[model samples]
Target: MARFRLLPDEQLARSPLRELWREFARQHSAMAGLALFLLFVVLAVLSPLLAPHDPYLQNDALLLIAPSWSEAGLVQYPFGTDDLGRDLLSRMLIGARYSFGIALITVLGALLTGLVLGSLAGMSKGLKSSALNHVLDLALTIPSLLLAIIIVAILGPGLINTIWAIMLALLPQFVHSVRNAIAEQLNLDYVIAYRLDGASNWQVLTRVILPNIWERLTVTASMALSTAILDIAALGFLGLGAQAPTAEWGAIIADSLDLIYVAPVGVALPGLLIFTCVLSVNLVGDGLRNAMKKRRDN
Candidate 1:
């Protein structure tokens, strides 16, 4: 008699771990991209716990100080003080929250808007799909940075407006991806069978095509999240994102620019923080994409 046996958890089993290690080795390029990204996210999420001082409190006496190897020699300012005497280290920690927050919102908003529009376009063919695709393509043709600048200029520069601008810039990509995914799945036999069973287009989309396209949608959304963070950081750097008095990474770095010569550390510190955040997010996305691909291939 043959005995039933359970397979070990692949995530922990030695063979599976070996395969995972091999995957990492084979995809070192992607793994490196993801590792850098993860490091930044850990920094951002742990900012409050890790910050050395109250970022908002200012001491005019310490203004424009440069970073020093000895904590005591640096007047206890690890990353030095900004022009306003605000602790650069603290400001960087707080700035992480806003940059990460804006990116999250923008990506989620774009995903929701894109999925809905794309589903509609995919379900309805001929003129409807053509028109929607044309509009999305036109929007995509405009440089995202230029479009973001124009929108932010009109809407007034602020956190919410910046998020909106980023979303607007990203939504078209989602729309295109979703439309293609849905269009590809719509003709599958399962979908045709659902229609034969008297399901409406909406029902078919919601039950059949949508479910099938979900994996692609999720991957695209994850990728978009990473891009959104970078874009928001860029806007903040340009003085079009979180404004004065708000400790946004971009704003902090921008404010530190004038004092670059006086205290180069001031400029480098915030910039490094932003870079880490963006890098970590991209890493997580890369890891996720790779893991999913491996699963599908298996």
Candidate 2:
């Protein structure tokens, strides 16, 4: 009798989307968070078409008009108008693009910087290791918000400068997290075995260690993104972030402080958006962490 080998069919492969939905359902809180986040993302992306008017264009006649529900109603401005007569809803939607865009860039930059620094520090030992580790520690010790404010003050308030400020503030935390993760992986038994088997340090680190810890790294990256979004919004609220006339959530809120009594939702819309975005990101992060942890345990 001849022995036959069988190859697994492609259809047998796992479904990532199904797995994701299952995970989402498993963590209802996170799922809710993700839903809110996705909603905001959709809103941001569709702002140009969905918005009642140009976010920048103003109508003095419609300025600060109280929102009405009596007739389906009130000229398409659901959230009301700002002090500048700009549609609050329109600004919030447009602001979503800038706010989310900056946060994503800030996190990516930080993650890349951290990954490189951490990998180098973990790979090297003795004085090189100690020096690099100490630098990362010191970097983390510095207060990010204060540093961002100072940097922004010096750079002048604008979207580009705000992104740079956020990146600078966020980089240290990324460096620390990545360094710790890498260091832990470097000392694992598998790594030692790989090294003993004549694997180069680079080979052990990249091939043996990195592959094993990639899931954890992915969780960390997502969590960092959530934090970055909140931090950017906070910076904008402080007036050290994205400048005026750019539809920034934080700036919108800051600008609406005076009109809080007259047009509450003008402040509320962006405030609510910031809250939901951050909350959603955090929820998604928690879900990812839990799922990854469970997989590891299994």
Q: What are the lDDT figures for the candidates, one per model?
A: 0.77, 0.76
Q: Candidate 1: TM-score? A: 0.84
Cα lDDT tens digits, model 1, 2-40, are 986666554444464466455645666567866665555
Residue 256 local lDDT, model 1: 74
The TM-score leader among the candidates is 2
| Model 2 Cα lDDT, one tens digit per residue, 219-267 | 7778777767777777888877776777988888888888788767878
The alpha-carbon deviation from the true structure for residue 74 of candidate 2, after best TM-score superposition, in angstroms, is 1.4
User: Best lDDT goes to which candidate?
Assistant: 1
Candidate 1 pairs with clashing backbones: 34-283, 37-279, 37-280, 38-280
TM-score of each: 0.84, 0.88
- Score candidate 1 by lDDT: 0.77
